[model samples]
Target: MILEKKVPELWTHLLMVAFAAVCVYVFLPSLLIIYKIIVTVILIVILSIDLVLIIRKKVNYLKLTRLALVNLSILLIIVCLIFYTTNFLVLTDANSLKSVLGGSTLMGKLLFLLICFLQPIVLPLPEAVTIPAGSAVLGSFNAAYLGYSGTISGIATMFLLARIGG
Candidate 1:
């Protein structure tokens, strides 16, 4: 006699829905802010709901860890892709951008850093290129320090905004 665990059809449907959500997310590009937010929220809600349902039905530590790792890996890869594409775009016009950044003066570098800090939040532009561009013009040490600090500040501001409700 062979013993097999039976699973409900709804389980298959849920798995398919999760796979489709992942596929759609992989294909979705950063376009409109509103659309992106809406789609992301929907995907997140669906995934969370499914994860909870699955976890409640069967709690496996190893499987949960694997799922977490997979999700982190996907997030990391998408972030890298965004940065890679933006960095290449900035690299091609390095000289012109360097010139436009107004040389290696302290004020100019600060301004560049400021713009980079704001680009990710205030402007529609991606922050990925700004740090690289800064590195090309303002030196690596300066770019890294300023870029990270500025990014931190911008992120902090966003957190405050989210907490305070506009």
Candidate 2:
């Protein structure tokens, strides 16, 4: 009985970790596309198995529904971002992106900052792409400062979102 109780708890934590890992993996540029896809698939499979085991072991329906909704929302957002980027964005090079972002105007800077700000929360852009471009356009110091602020704000927004969801 004790072991049974512990198993569910263990699976719950594992599921959370797997989900978090997958989310982190998706945005951070890995060495290769094939490796990324393979690892993500394994993590997702683990997550799905853990979810099934936890559900089978008996959990509250209300909590389950809330969890499902939050997961679904995140998946939807990621899918939409992928679709938008693939269909609308043409420039894949960092230098071109830097030129566009660095229009050498106040409005351009603000837009660049905004992109950095949303990168974590909504945009599925790798930091590699944004940071280098920002550095070239805004210089190292200004780019770092703006990027740091945007990242922090994005993190805070995610925290608020999790709180609201719960």
Candidate 3:
């Protein structure tokens, strides 16, 4: 009975490690496209599994799903607000896109990137808008760098929060 109780925990840890290794390996330039597809598939599979488990009542899946739904709803609302605000600012401001992009200067760009990085961790914002906006405004390389930085930072923040809460 004790062994059975521990098995699930062990399996979860192993799966997490495996996924992390896969992500690390996928970071190589040669694997970029494949990595994207793999990641998407993996996410879908994980979500499907969670939904199945919730339906089966095999775990506290219902509570987890509820939490996830709440978070997603909050994220959507924040994203909408940000989109509207950004559009309004751009429309009201006399500066054109070219001027804003050209005149933002390095510091402005860095500040924008920092906000994008911090949003996921500090706010309930959906990253869809911020990430694409970053790519559009900052270009591909900087967009990737900032996105990765934000992701890592957000993960770290979540880890710390969980630890503290626990």
Candidate 4:
């Protein structure tokens, strides 16, 4: 009797697994690098748990997943645009208005870093913009530090949002 009830849920589980496998495959090189493997595994586990909850009808996983997917899609598009613009700037004039800003004063560099740090959490700017601007103005080490700070800030914001929302 219980087996009869669970059979359909089992099928749903299988389908979700297959769909997730396809998503992982399609995202392979980006997701499969040695450094990223752990993160990828964690994400897969989270998704799997969410799928189980969805199948059990214990949660509104669909709405959550849909929101995540939409946000991810937007981020991807912004990332691509940033990459394209960066490449274009590097390949084309290379001495345009942005390049001029790249050679800003020390105060300017600090200001730019602060903006980059805030933008991710507050404004949602493309990281590529912040990175190149940092590299050009602050050099590689400072740029890396600024980027790390921005990521930390973003993570903190996400945590706060999750805590509040949950």
- Residue-pair clashes per prediction, in order, are 0, 0, 0, 0
Ranking according to TM-score, highest score first: 2, 1, 3, 4
Write out the backbone clash pairs for model 4. none
lDDT of 3 by residue, 33-152 (tens): 775566455545555665576456565553454454345445445655675666545622223332444457686467556655666666444566555666677787887787788678
Q: Estimate each model's TM-score.
A: 0.40, 0.46, 0.36, 0.34
Error of 1 at 123 (Å): 1.7
Candidate 1 runs further than 4 Å off? 1-96
Cα lDDT of model 2 by residue, 1-166, tens digit = 5346656555565656555455545553433677556656655665565566556764343255346435744764585568557643643468777778766667757867887788788877788988888888888898898888998898888889989986
What is the Cα-based TM-score of model 1?
Answer: 0.40
The residue ranges of model 2 lying beyond 4 angstroms of the native Cα positions read: 1-88
By lDDT, the best candidate is 2
**Candidate 2: clashing pairs of residues:** none
Kindly report which residue pairs in candidate 1 clash with one another: none
Q: Write the per-residue lDDT of candidate 1 for residues 1-166, one digit (tens) a residue.
A: 0111213333543554465455445544444568556645655665565466555765333344346435644764586578567754653354655776755488867787676677557755455656677787788898888888888888888788888995
Instruction: Report residue 156 deviation for candidate 2 (angstroms).
Output: 0.6
Q: Hey, what RMSD does candidate 1 come out at?
A: 13.6
Better of 2 and 4 by TM-score: 2
Q: Determine the backbone clash count of candidate 4.
A: 0
Worst 10 residues of 1 by lDDT: 1-10
lDDT pick, better of 1 and 4? 1
- Residue-wise lDDT of candidate 4 within 7-45, one digit each (tens)? 565465445545444444453335446634553564466
Q: Rate the local accuracy (lDDT) of all candidates.
A: 0.60, 0.66, 0.56, 0.57
